[model samples]
Target: MLEEDLLYVLALQRVKGIGDINAKKLISHCGSAKNVLKEKRQTLEKINGIGAFTIKHLFDSNNLIEAEKELEYIQKNNITTFYFEAENYPEKLKHCIDAPILIFKEGNFDLSNRPIISIVGTRKITSYGRYFCEKLISDIKQYNPIIVSGFAYGVDICAHKAALKNKLTTIGVLAHGFEEMYPKSHKKYVSEINKNGGFFTDFWHNDSLIRENFLKRNRIVAGISEATIIIESAEKGGSLVTADIANSYSRDVFAVPGRSSDNLSKGCNDLIKRNKAAILTSANDLIEMLNWDIETKKEHIIQKQLFVELDETEQLVYDFLVDEGKELLDIISLNCELPIYKTTTILFNLEMKGVVKPLPGKLFEAI
Candidate 1:
């Protein structure tokens, strides 16, 4: 993005009452952030859901000044910004209604990993939760899914370390700005996380840490991934809130079941009981639910002649399977750069031609 465009976006973000949703609305209606700021009050008022209170500070000069300073800070610190309407933004997060209009990512993480899963739970994690978190990541490391979590204590840190150990990318979503690291102690591990994945936050530089900010940041944690997993929680906590947000987004949620007598398990049990989450017993539960299969082959393959006639799209999927050996439907679609529906049709055609066969767990292989 151009410097001027970023400046205006920052200024829009600095507005007191206008949040992501309203900012998006205003920008969509006016064409751009600069246009929104330059548009007259009468015009802005005509836009629905943008009330007097929301736009009262829209024209504040102080917002622009602060934005200018923040823009400088962002440039100096080498922070990468993801705009909502841009292709560079995370694809899964783009579908969320309340996703951040501008996300500041500080790290070398790649966001292309399919089947992103967010693991969240009580800060006071139990031994069981810790064990489950570590083992789950280790088990699914082969699938190469990115693991996401708040960089808080207990389950979050455990998940991150486990992902690191398994050489998998892990993202830490933060409540504060890059200028300040919460829980000061975790600062020691920031370098490793930046190398493996990185931290994501919508908060501006020097934003103070407040209790409410944790809850507000939960939306990003929930909205940025395909599923949210709860390791352990009491009846109430920030992780439960993340689960609720994920549910609201129509994303899958999984809760590791625990003993009824355990205090930390209450929140997860409640979620499962209310049908807010699927009971996650192991990595297989998540793998199967998400249809991410790592099983490479079935009992046997029906050999096909070398000269099977195939069109361009079918050839693409066929070559991908031949090279990959075996892969899930979504993986094939992603690797071949084809849509799932189109890939499914191509796979069906290949199957009819006796060149491909569907295995269990939605996997397919070249025959």
Candidate 2:
């Protein structure tokens, strides 16, 4: 976006009652934010859904003044802004109706052509949650996904750290702005995170941290990725909200199942029971659901004879492939009575053993 255009967009963002959807509508109607701001109230109100209340403050001069100050801050700090229509904006997030029109980014990582997933859960994470979160990232690290999460305590930090441990890029979606870091304790991870991935926020630099900011932040966490995973949540928590937001965007959502008696597992259980989220047990579940296994085929170079031993699970999949000749991933999973993710994992193992190979369109055959 041009600096002059960004100034108008930032001013429009500061306008009361003008949200992303309306901002977009106004922009579409008038060709640009600058045009919208300069248009007469009667001209703006002629458009559908543009009520008197919406454009009442649209022409406020303070909006321009404040935007100029923000522009100065952005220029001095070298902050990057993603206009919704720009090519640099996240592709998946752009499809979302309520996506922010302008999001301030402070990261060096790219969001293109890679599988991205958001991992969110309770701040009060348990030992099981921590273990599953860490192991999940480790197992899926081969796919080189960009992990997305809030930079909070427990599951959020755990996901980021696990991604770091696996040498994967991990992005933190901040609830506040770059002016200050929340929780203060997490300040230590900022430098390392930026080196590995970075941070994104729609909030201005001067925005203050508050409780509601978390709920607002959840939308980005959900929208920016191909899938959202709730490692663990109580019967109620912000992670559940993220799941809802992901579902609303028609994005895949997965929740790790926990023991029924566990408190942190309640929200995930509810999500599964309500059919709002798929039951997630391993990295394979996520991998298959998101079709991330397809990347392996592109990078495939190893071709081995059937000299490697097959474990029980791998043998089951291999045998099925042998009998079926060629089968879709879903068919293999159904016939083997394995979850799709588990089936994908088995197929990957079998491919490594050189007795199976993935065909086009997610088909697999015995080699």
**How many residue pairs clash in each candidate at the backbone level?**
0, 0
Whole-model alpha-carbon lDDT for candidate 1: 0.87
- Pairs that collide, model 1: none
For model 2, what is the error of residue 264's alpha carbon versus the real structure, in angstroms, after optimal superposition? 0.4
Quote each prediction's TM-score: 0.81, 0.81
- Model 1 residue 233 lDDT? 95
lDDT of 2: 0.88
lDDT of 2 at 84: 93
Q: List the residue pairs that clash in candidate 2.
A: none
Off by over 4 Å in 2: 295-367
Query: Residues 1-367, candidate 2, lDDT per residue (tens digit)?
Result: 7899999999999998898899999999999999999988998898999889888889889999999999999999999999998999999999999999999988679988888999999999899899999999999988889999999999999999999999999999999989889879999999998999999999999999999999989999999997899999999889999998988776778899988999999999999888788789888777665556655532332232234677888878877865675677888899999999899888887877677766433667775
Score residue 53 of candidate 1 by CA lDDT: 81
User: lDDT of each model, Cα atoms only?
Assistant: 0.87, 0.88
lDDT of 2 at 147: 96
